[model samples]
Target: MKKFLMLLLALLTVMVIAACTANEDAGEDPTDSEEPDTTEEGTNDDDEDATDDGTEEKVLRLNNGIEPSSLDPSIGFDAVSWDPLNNLMEGLTRLDQDSRAAEGVAESWDISDDGLTYTFHLREDVNWSNGDPVVAEDFVFAWKYMLDPETASPAAFLGYFIEGAEAFNSGEGSADDVNITAVDEKTLEVVLEAPTGFFLDLLTNPAFFPINHQVAQDNPNWHTEAESFVGNGPFKLESWEHDVEMVFTKNEHYWDADTVKLDKVHFAMVNDSNTQYQMFESGELDTASIPPELSDELIDGDNVFIGDYGGLEFYRFNITEEPFHNKNIRKAFAYAVNRADIAEYVVKNGVEPAYGFVSPGFTSPTGSDFRDENGDLVTFNPELAQQYLEDGMAEEGYNELPEIVLTYNTSDSNKAVAEALQSMFNEHLGVEVTLENQEWNVFAEAQQNLELQFSRSSFINDYSDPVNFLESFVTDSYMNRTGFSSAEYDELIEKGKSETDEEQRWEYLYEAERMLAEEMIAMPIRYYNTVVLEADGVSGILRHPVGYFDLKFADKN
Candidate 1:
């Protein structure tokens, strides 16, 4: 019996082994195979794989699309084009290498007993590009000059946050009477009306950049004139021709002079992206962008710079005017137009559609989000919009809406959107819309004047905050050219500033946005990916929430 049991066990073991082998064979097919990657594009970036013996000089040439026409920090500067500007003229406090506010012109600041007052300590030995001692009074002058109504500075909006800034800007008070004062050679004091929560970020604005006050006073047109320039940051404008090219040389006297590796930085006006891309590929231009029409073919995992942006490209209506004054009309207009169609067709080339003023990934440290009832979010609802428009038309006693005018910038991408929207509004809502295109500079002025019935303008938040975009439209805001002011909206915004409870504050903000969106104050289009082309070796170009890409700390690798 023992011999027979041993034989049975041996047979069972063989049977189990054979079954396991059969299962393994059925699970995977040996005939299917993939080889290792020997392709050039799939290689990892390490020291050995970096180049084909490419040992080029560190001098990098950055080919930005447009040139900064005015070196004046105050002149109607677009932060989009001012990244290099802030590099040259830094603020007392500035966005860090990673977009957070850090010390720049001033070493430190101390707030007083009243939250409204602040005292700042400057870095003593800092010098200007011309080798002049940078004093506390330089910043003081810059602040006052911006507040002066005659300066016509777009940056003045930032100054308005300070005490008496509004009065000074509106010509109700002298620039001299503005609250900033130089306590001594190295100390500066500022007085504010309320606790400006984002004050540090406000200090990060170019309007606070120190300038040679004497030069500015001597030459009023110093912005456009060659005789009126000095530097507080890394680079100095050696030369610039309007709409042409700009040349910059490193500041020999910069406080961080030892760290600035690049000796010269240059920019040329090549607005056309394709022309710019060809130059970049040929090694003539260092960096270039794929134009809207060509973005998809160019965009992929390789060589793609992907990140969150703080800008919102919204469609605004002149609310103080007739058509927009009617909330129903606004609702009807929003319903009449299709956002998905706009997102797919009008805003082609990977631009994300905007559901509200604030985009995701953007944060507000002091405040909460500006979301709505569904919690700071709302998507296209054509059926709902149609009902609102139908009601509005009935109230206005009109079966068909009159012809509307939409003014947009003459950019290659913008024209496509405006033309597409014109058709969408006409066919979807039965509204006749005319598209009027104009030069960028001219179009900006017209939109600000409320001359256009409807316009497309974008506001990139100065800081990653809810207030940065929403507060800029509060009745008294300079950018509030549409005159869209509601007492309820204003109260809710002001309440949000002081509400100690975090959740309540957010609720109020969300309510205000819901009111605004429901009222159809304006239609949000989408958020843009700020694409730029820079030289291969250029690193440390600081990107900001506001489109200003300041490059002072930038060093060529």
Candidate 2:
């Protein structure tokens, strides 16, 4: 029994020693066996740390107000396009925070003493997002494209300052006759028909922006999609989901890309101010326009801002149509509205009743505002309105008034203003009007097609010049959706454009403004106020006086 016990103990000890040896063979070094700590945050190399909570940068959330009709600079002519284009593309010059002309693609420029010739020196370091060198010929191509009748750009009139541009647009001259020339790869020269003081300011507009010549030639639809959308600005289109949201990512190839702080910019197309405000409250938006319902409560708040946007809200009569064709009918409709009440009640954001087309911010030769110099030339007098309506009714030989349709873009604020105008027309002129609402693009198309009798419209300056407002009234102006034209008005504006003396030019413009008010060209409603809501941590955002809200210079805290 003793011998058997000893042998079993030795065998057990041998088995234990074999198990220990196997464990030693399977063991690993501590440095190699320790698990990796993925929880320690690390940057993504693909986007260069564009993650939401990364240490590098945050995305800027913005509201575009309306879905832009097109991203093509030659095709887009309104604030909806201009605002985004200002960041996505650049002109020879661009507007700074104060709406002053600033250097853009052109590093510097020299202007002749007569102001008829401008020579631009472009930066050699600049290239398109696609890596193509941006050259002077690009500007020449863009200018010619804008003036080409085939392009049918609504902003074709903007090219009129160039020598022979009018003749080219009118089909009387060749595109080659337009005096824009590329002296070299880095130099661009422009010759104007007359000395224009605001030429640099005009160049800041998107109509004068450059396009990649090869890209445009390769794909006519390149601008319509993100995959093909190439730009040379601080931001480039990453994704464009039509009518919903547009996303812009920073262009790593931009010459000044180092200065761009935001990783991306997201533009949410929320047409309704109420919806935009809700998004703002939900932290989905960084900026929004104050809804008319919330205007009174938020107008004085710290984040709410009111801008003296150099624009006027007006309802234009389709002068080519039946009753509106008569001057007396148009005048009667113009005088019928109580503009002050509308401004105070309907659009309660800081908008003032606009008695004339020119808003109050423009300075005259004597340093007084043009609007202050001409105070309320078109007054609100119901008696005169009724009398004029009666005369129009008599002239038309109609005992029954025609049904008028007032069309406006879809929005709570627009609907409110339309309802107020409807009530005013019913009360003051005994006219029954129908209010029609459509989406912004649809309404814009209808206006462009002249399919609406009366449509709500507004003019934000393309530049600070008064001609930017008055030029739309010219007979052939593509911006003239109203079809209201006069030879005298066109002649006066032509003289104003060429007039060199400051006082003389202002006098011409003043006369034109008087003519507009006296003839009751359109039913001027109110001058626009900025009226916006800004979230915390947003700084350096520029709300241009002409209604362009840009974020290229903005920073997110």
Candidate 3:
């Protein structure tokens, strides 16, 4: 760990020096350039490759880790789908090069003084891949469909702030109660239940992306195949080979097509990190995630790029399952594992040991870090673990504890972490736990159905706020797979969302996190930090700390 830190410091120093040198050469202040040059064309004077027309065809190759679970914007909420979807289709707002919410389909918007209503005016020139003009009805239909109870979209909870959306999703109200309307052909009006400061930021999520109502009506499975997919973003899905690869070509009809630098973006569905690293080395992929086992060896590599990522790696205990049903037993298992060792020894990718659900990097109204404000709530303590196990056994009136299984998806890093956890449980609590692994799709379905006892999970922030992490545990949230419910916790989260006073809202969030830790609802192992290797001459790829990749402005030599 110490060696890794030193190397990171050296890399930062080199970057600073390079930035200063570039600024001096350009005779401009470093702070003046806060965002990258997204409007630049890919035509470089030093380019060597040329076609018959004497123009080079620019393409960017990447690995998606696995085939997207689904291409439907509302259904594909995980990272595997998000990265490609973010480029293939756009929402009302898109994350800019600086990771700030910027206009996409919406040319401009107006908000009422009460902050309850938002009126977005769509860009007149924005057209889908099929050359159909994008209209406000697309947004309205997509939003209502996402909130429809029959759709069963996992991301439905994200739209709860919309007036009557929660009720409609819970089957207590009709779609008319959703409070979204197409004021005109290009105007979309939405009313929120309460004043939300992060409404624009929330719209950056792919779940809020618009769907072409006409296309969907003509074919129900428009998003399943590239030929049928209709998108109004910088890129359009050109081809899709399930579980193999996908190809995206620039959308000539895009509103901002002139700003798109690359002609094609190719995604290879390779789940193994080491294999991806090898591909990147052999010039098959432009960027690849660093495998934990090779982190130390590659830390000083010139191609490596490390940045803060807002997410958490954790394990969820199904309260309805045996052994984990008791709160005491859950706490026993949580306290038995050493998170620091896992972050340092097992997943050595510059991640910080996590003691709270919210990853570090969020600032409160008081200008303090949310994680630092809430100190370590859970830690390794073998003695406390033993005591809690005994108390839980006594409470259950059992001479022996029931068998427990730690389930995870098939991945090299996940397997390593699961094995380390198994050893820790056996050593600290004298509990012999079994480990199981399954494919990504199968495991995701099982976890969602609460079929797994204790399973590995992760949460990436959809917005730049601490509440995004806290809201996942709400009793009615589809993301809440642990089967743990608490009226107080739910109320606290409600207050956090509805409370107007920033300070008081933060107070609610802090209290809710405390309650979660006190009950040991989930065992937090580490906070994520993105570590990837990018080949030379690849630039302008926007990797937002709280969001997915933005390849619209990316260029390759």
TM-score per model over all chains:
0.83, 0.89, 0.90
lDDT of each: 0.63, 0.76, 0.81
Pick the winner on TM-score between candidates 1 and 2: 2
Candidate topping lDDT: 3
Over 83-111, each residue of candidate 1 has an lDDT whose tens digit, in order, gives 55676777788787677788887899898
* Global fold similarity of model 3 (TM-score): 0.90
Off by over 4 Å in 3: 1-52
Model 3 per-residue lDDT at 138: 97
How does candidate 1 fare on TM-score? Answer: 0.83
**Candidate 2 segments whose C-alpha is farther than 4 A from its true place:** 1-56
